[model samples]
Target: MPEPANALQRLHVHLNETRLLGSISSALYYDQNTVMPAAGAEWRGEQLALLASQIHARQSSARYAELVGEAEAELEAETKAELGPSVPTERRRNLQLVRLELERQRCLDPALVASLARAQSKGNALWQTARRHNDFPTFAPALAELIALRREQAGQLAAAEAVPRSPWEVLAQPFEPDISKTRLEELFSPLKATLPGLLEQVAAAPAQQGGLNEAAAELPEAEQESLCSELLNSWGYDPARCQRSRSAHPFSCTLGPQDFRITTRVVPGQPFSSFLATAHEWGHSLYEQGLPRSTDHYFPWPLGEATSMGVHESQSLFWECRVARGRAFAARWQPRFVAGAGGDPWGGVDGFWRALNPMRPGPTRVEADELSYGLHIVLRFELELALLEGGLPVADLPGEWNRRMVELLGLRPASDSEGCLQDIHWAEGLFGYFPSYALGHLISAQLAAAMQRQIGPIETHVAAGQERVVQQWLAAHVWPLGRAVNGEELVEQVTGERLSAAPFLSYLEAKVQQLLASAHH
Candidate 1:
């Protein structure tokens, strides 16, 4: 094509290139997790380190800053000339976002950038082995190195922040902008106070007889895969733009504007694991696919990206917890599951729903019920604060993790794999991301309420096998907002209320009563 005459056009070209590099990094990461061989990790780390350094250089370079400056000057002139608020609003916001990101990138040392990439790659490899062997010692050194590197990173980025922030807060800002520990405490305190009591209520209830066992719940991997495919197809998963694979940990990622990937692992006995995980990951993929990618201004721009990890998680949990685990969905799909397993293991539809909505507290966070999921996040959020700010030693993590698990959920992990090493976030030096998971539950609940208010009941649509209507609502309301707002702002804008633990807690209570009522029948 011809060379761009305008500064804005030139800046678009620059951002497009930057997005290309970032997507390449994502592709490499996806491969590493899904199919890359064990021995290739070292070379992959080196490759990623090189790419990280190059991308940092491009983002922080004087030339890119000059282009951004020129674009801002042109945008201001155009905005002043315009009669109304049509083009200038989103474009102006995009430029502002770009400027802030530029400042933060400029503050980081390139060596540190490269080092962090290598550390993250190495840390992920170490974590996989360590988790598999239940060996925390083998992974502790890498975790310490990552924490030290990230602390230094936070210290550097603090200078670029518009407001004063603590080290943990600084590290967290990239995930949830304008987030503070005080706000997290305010939001999570309700969960801390209430969830355990709810858990106790479930625990104190009499156990239902003839519940599912390992043998009863087991489905072969092939059957699980088939069921997952059916679920995705029923929910609008198009293979042309989206692909599914297996991974150690379930996740979804965008390799490019059109390339979406999700992965889930089938456990030996947990028949629901792969199916629910597929739903969860596809929810993430749907959000990614629905993001603004139509115009050039959207794809290579901040507005095209996800607003926050919390919102992203809300999408996943909406499918996993809200829809897949709901009574309507269980009633709908229980027949297929029984056919796949060659037996009616769950006894009946209500029994299948109970199996899906197992309300008991558990050692594993991924396998946790709605009542206990937020507590898992609370435990991680506090431990992160303790490790990053409260001077908790790395060697003491296992003990501390176990103590918190018992305190919060009344369960203790039997091994390091199930305890401190359960999540891959800390291993990769993600200090402030856990809170978003809890925040997601809250956001999902509140949004669901709003969605129900607008379109009657979600369960009604779900029971009617009209999930497309639900997807249409979210696509119109939620996905297009993108980075125009932060997580809480998005919640308030969509739901007309500030995010809180109330909706999620209320939903959990009602669901628990329903489950108990069914048990009595």
Candidate 2:
């Protein structure tokens, strides 16, 4: 084999081993969330620490660096070759992946990586316990440790190379590679400027009175599970390939090319919570299931993996916001929901729709409405950026979080569980993941617009119970590409336009307006 070919083979071997380790880590994470007892938290932290050290050792190994260097040289030579352009393109792509891994690995010391992994594992447990007791102080020290480690990691990444943008940009790259702070501000500035007024208009509009508010009264867990299964089957999820379970914070995970798992929490009075969460998670699983199988199976290569969390969020938002909250969906499923909750089915489609789109400010990010959801993200983005920049101390997070909640959403959390301890992202050391939720909303609107153009009336199809049509459209245009394209390129390819705030803003304005108009009549 040529030097480049040999390097490529070695890189692949390293990547495959890293991928296996990652898969095991993912499974362990799932276990931690779903089945592991509290007593196991310390051991889990050690296991994760060991795994992180192993992965870091493999990544930072001198042999790996040599292989990457050789691959880079081969890529340059192939770039200069004139005979077969496609070969060079493939080589350059592979080289790009290798270089990205090298840069990421080189940015953080192995000790720091191991420390972060252990901190995150322990922090998760602390967060759970703190949340259960509605106490932030109990988890504050662990959170502070995580914040310190993440800030150090950000600094390390910034020092690895001269980054053109802010340190936050470099830190955010792992979650949303190629996205700049300027771009995020451009996409979000308009929403920030316009949403308050829009929200006021909807809130002042005649209140739609008649929706069910079946507070978590006494719903059985078994019944909730059964209903979740029914909804999953209705959504075309095959039980053999996809499984569901319960977790404190619901999430979806893909174990392999074919295996996917989703979790939902059962809120006693509000059975819709679990059902809707199931739908949201199903959206994510469907995207994973629909990824192009022809490409290699391992993640981090940008072949079968997701393009970005923003794109992945779009899939879930499409199902949860666009489809589940729509008039047609509520009309078809309201009967089942009413029957399950023993509520009045007479709430009418308009009333049910308004209830679904309620614009109340909330403490929980996951339960936030479309209009106010971005505000939640903006709070975290600012806090994390400050933390990364050394402008804020982790010790001040609870106060800062409470202040931001009041400033942004005009509400304050009654307890720490509803405030600083709400999300699992920070506990897991996911510093840059919050913004993707809002970004996903924008992408979903853009993609939905494109789907409408291609498939002719989506609302009509949705109202007529033709979810398969929408699913098929997304599978064909969006899901199959996987990480074969980046988020911006995928948006452009599907929408024939660049990424912009207009599509999302327009969709939100129209939906809110329709809801308001219907409520009045």
Candidate 3:
């Protein structure tokens, strides 16, 4: 804990302060989404724009660039003296990531950065209002403005990218580095071919197929909150390090190194939404909490960051889908739901498990079941490509969305709120982000196979209420790696197989057969 007296130390100090500024923005964002009133939207937009400009300036400044160069030179000298030449190190990787980001930041105009931030804030505010009113027209102009600003931003960053990338790909780099359109199509092709068939099979099954969706009694909101709290406490949610709140959409946010927050919304008729969302968001927080930040130097460096949104989503899905939605988990929690409702509303444990594993399609992506979730992502992915790359008009989004829904999930949304405005990603100008949700399913399934190979089945742990065992397995294998590898490499490293959709499709198929068999009993 000595004072900084070297180039590397100075770089750490600089980055630490920069992270402080960035965290301020995160805190404001959490407040805006959670508690900010409607009248505060414009001022919030201005505040966010000002911070965006400042953060952009700091990242792209010549002073910061010089410090990075000095740090690189210093690290090289230290490595050469302490070890042999040509040896790679995590510090080296950290510097490389920082340099890449610096170049991208330098390529952008500060004015554009401010404009994009303002537009994103405005777009989010407008989207909430429009969604509540089921009025797409009110939000269409904001969406158009976000798209234009983001396109311009991508155009500016394109020159700085080492390889040629499409506008959407350029925007996606921050979320999933080194991802390409060709690779996505390769990964998604199997899902596109297989999932619809699975959906059709479920549709043709006998009564009780894919669970009795309308049979469960709805738990009161207060009961849902209490149950959700119990679920988190059981899963190692420490009140000291984390907090939960209500929001328009469920999400996880990190404000400081130790300060974590998650939000969930209770759908009146959907009794398990809050409980499952809590589990999902807690998965995200656990990963963030477990990132390699044991020291002051690590938190500010790239090596301490989550590698990709896909991998992040994988962690959340591991808890939400693999564990929370698994039969063993349902058996353990069935009594709790029953007690909360003051009656056995789901008939029995098997019926409760069926409710948790509803294998049907839906209009909203967030509430879609595991069997049809990939289809939701596929729909959004295709639409994103069209909107960003194919010049799909904003006004036509609703019409095209309904068309794709019928083709993909065989259901059309009756309102814009459930259709195009269900997600908060595009409202904030987040293009090329939906694909990660599908990728998460694939990654989670593959990683679960690997976990089972090493320790035991995840279901076994859930049955004994030993989720900490599952958490430990991930902590040792996945969390520590951080940005040491991207999403695909992390999968291959852990699972000893190249990433594919076979594991996910296999899981879904087996799940379908099990649920169908349970109906007979």
Model 2 TM-score (2 dp): 0.93
Top candidate by lDDT: 1
Most TM-score-accurate candidate: 1
Model 2: residues with Cα > 4 Å off, grouped in runs: 1-7, 69-83, 86-91, 160-162, 213-220, 295-300, 343-346
Each prediction's TM-score versus the true structure: 0.98, 0.93, 0.98
For candidate 1, write residues 355-452 as lDDT tens digits.
Answer: 89888888888888899999999999999889888999999999999999999998889999989988888878898999988989999999999999
lDDT of 1 at 125: 99
lDDT of 3 by residue, 1-521 (tens): 66577987888888888999999999999999999998999999999999999999999999999999999898888787876455456778888889999999999999999999999999999999999999999999999999999899999999999999999999988888899999999999998899899888878875555345464577899999999999999999889989999999999999988899999999979998999999899999999998988673378899889979999999999999999999999999999988988888677889899888778888988898997899899899889889989989999999999999999889999899999999999999999888888999999999998999999888999999999999999999999888888989999998999999999999988998988888778
Model 1 lDDT-worst window of ten = 206-215
Superposition TM-score, candidate 1 onto the true structure: 0.98
Instruction: Rank candidates by lDDT, best first.
Output: 1, 3, 2
**Residue-level lDDT for 309 in candidate 1:** 94
The pairs that clash in candidate 1 are: none
Residues 36-130 of candidate 2 have per-residue lDDT tens digits of 99999999999989998998888878888987787677656666785456563545655666677687788788889999999999999998998
lDDT of each: 0.91, 0.80, 0.90
